[model samples]
Target: MQADIQLLLTADGSHTVRHETLGVTYHSIHGAVQESQRVFIELGLQAAFERFANVPLRVFEMGFGTGLNALLTAREAERHGRPVAYTGVEAYPLPPEESQKLNFDVALGTTFLNALHASPWHETVNISPFFTLNKQQTSLQNWQTNERFHLVYYDAFAPSAQPELWEPEIFQRLACFLLPGGLLTTYCSKSYVQRNLRAAGFTVEKHPGPARKREVLRAISPPIL
Candidate 1:
């Protein structure tokens, strides 16, 4: 079930991909960069930094998509001189030519985009002194790792578009890899999704979202005894 995709300019003048068949955009049409910065960066990464302090951060991104979130996280790690190990899981990766067309690098004034996509799958690649990436080519449902993560960027397509991915069982499985006190953040604010997170043993919160979005969800794992 390969997605028929096309690139489109977003409200913030950044680019995002739309799955033609699913009728869903990879990021918010409001602004791809703005959404990523707000949902995954400010609320997700920054919050993790505050909680973990100077410790190395491990992040697992559910859908690598355009690599925008990873790029933003990498830049943040470099800015703070903090170490971050990022693992992004994508079942169907965008082709090289497709990723090259995204305007994220130009928007952020950085050229790490190509290096991010070119990194070998299933192996860690040091993109910078502070950031390393492991782009795993597997679906989140099937992906497994004994290694736990400090943060999770749940950037999958909307539930309406991909209901299977939003199921409670899937969330439970992902929750197992989150270290106690780790967070899972997403642009989705659906009640069912929140219930699923709660069912998976997360303390979920809804926060003011970015741009046109009203709310986003952030779920934290319970602290270990």
Candidate 2:
């Protein structure tokens, strides 16, 4: 059964969702927008642009959740007039009723958010001239794609919640789909997680995190020699 979701107002007045059964929140309770901006936008996206600005950027996300990360990415794409192809894979797609109620629009604009939710799955839809989205209603484990990505917004549930997803084999699978020198950012900075990333052949860096957390992890795939 799908876990019931409840809308939550975070410290920054942005909305996140809480899983009624699992007791997990979609984003940080301290401040949702800041966390996404700091980790995904500022760190992940910007870094990708600096290195690979010659071509349209490709992004893959583990959890589509509330479309917060995708919406933010679209906004950046429009601002810079750079093309972005984003793929969000979700095992349990959020119901439209709940996803539509999120307040990310107030801060990041809703045009893309609305389109992101309404867009059909398994099809490439242009949410904006510069941003195209492919929403897949499936888990990463079962997802098959030969498309290589430049950045990965790994926003899955915490390791404590889904231990299987944090293993070395999973990281190896993610690394396989990423282009050489591609970046992967995740909110979890656990020591063992970093070790798993290294075991999967990624070079990991610990970055400062947002409220209630000290650090995050940004892992880079080995560059071609």
Candidate 3:
């Protein structure tokens, strides 16, 4: 089902899309860019870099949405001279008219935001020397791939809005694609979600969230026996 969406300015002056039907915002209401940087970038990608070093990172994102996380990750890859193979899955993509209004290009000081959205789905496109993107137009439930990932940006709509995506079975399914010691980060800290991740064989941790959010989750796939 398509959502009736509207772009709204968040507290940190970044733009986020709100689904009127689901009553949920794409990113935190606090600050889209700030939350993305903290949860996905600092805690997710950077943390993975510490363990993996300069090796090319295979990153998988659950929901592409506004492409903010991908944009930031691409920029980070460029800054650090690291290689990143990024894949984002979005069942319902935002049209160009809607995505164009986001101010992330100005906020991040890069014009590649448009190129990100323009790239064709289900095909790998080299956004830059350090960043390669594959935008998949499918739901995580239906999308299948043999390639494992080093990091997963689980930016799905909140559990309250999309309960199916956060269930234990789903976590178990996604865990299959995570390399041993791989990391998955999300701006959600619900107790049941943590339990679900644990049940799916992940070691979970809670970190300080960005902006007004108090806490977020970071889960790591256990090393192979």
Candidate 4:
């Protein structure tokens, strides 16, 4: 696997980027990671959490990458005192030493980096009173879990770089883990991606993308009767 480390700028002039499999971080010119945080974490995850305002919010994340999304979620859960269970799947997990540099406090400011790195990896680990993070270091294609997720952060590499992750079969498998009314959000809003989500039995929507991008994708499953 290739690894890239570089800088990327957000619409608000924030910087973020770290590659695990692809040299040269920061997609194109603008900040890919920053856009991800804005679109997925802030808009997608937080919105889903708000709609389901019960304790113990369960979140599933694809492409753990630099652990930025998890760190952001941890900060929000801790600050808001909302119990959260976060499950992140990554084919190639980033080393703790590398993840420590995420430093959400510097950018988002919530001491999330420390908490995330401090949380030991095992079968499961509780990071704080409000946050429990479980990491699966395997391709999501092979993951199996009956646990239903209220929200999913689908932040994979671009379609051009990694086409396999965008396949319909993978989406179909992932859709099974989402409970009725669960929502999935990603930065890509291509028509093909939306079609895949729909084929997987989701109600898909095309939304304005973050930063320089044109559009994003959000999907929701109907509640089980």
Candidate 2 residue lDDT tens string, 1-225: 255788999999899998877768889999999999888988899899887977999999998988999999999988888899999999888887888788898876557778888999999999999999999998889999989999999999877677898999999999998999999999999989999999999999989998888999899998861
Clashes of 4: 0
lDDT of 4 at 195: 87
RMSD (Cα, Å) for all candidates, in order, is 1.1, 1.2, 1.0, 2.7
* Candidate 1 error regions (>4 Å): 1-3
The models' CA-based lDDT, in order, is: 0.92, 0.90, 0.92, 0.74
Residue-by-residue lDDT tens digits, candidate 3, 1-225: 355899999888889999999999998888899999999999999999898895899999999999999999999999999999999999999988999899999987987899999999889999999999999999999999999999999999988889999999988887888999999999999999999999999999999999888999999998971
Which 10-residue span in candidate 2 carries the lowest summed lDDT?
A: 105-114
Error of 1 at 12 (Å): 0.7
Selected candidate, larger lDDT, 2 vs 3: 3
Q: Which candidate, 1 or 4, has the higher lDDT?
A: 1
State model 3's lDDT: 0.92
Q: How many Å off is the CA of 173 in candidate 1? A: 1.1
Model 3 spans > 4 angstroms off: 1-3
lDDT of 4 by residue, 24-123 (tens): 3533246544676667777677888787887578899887776678877877787788888998887766565556655446766566566665565546
Q: How many pairs of residues collide in each model?
A: 0, 0, 0, 0
TM-score of candidate 2 relative to the true fold: 0.97
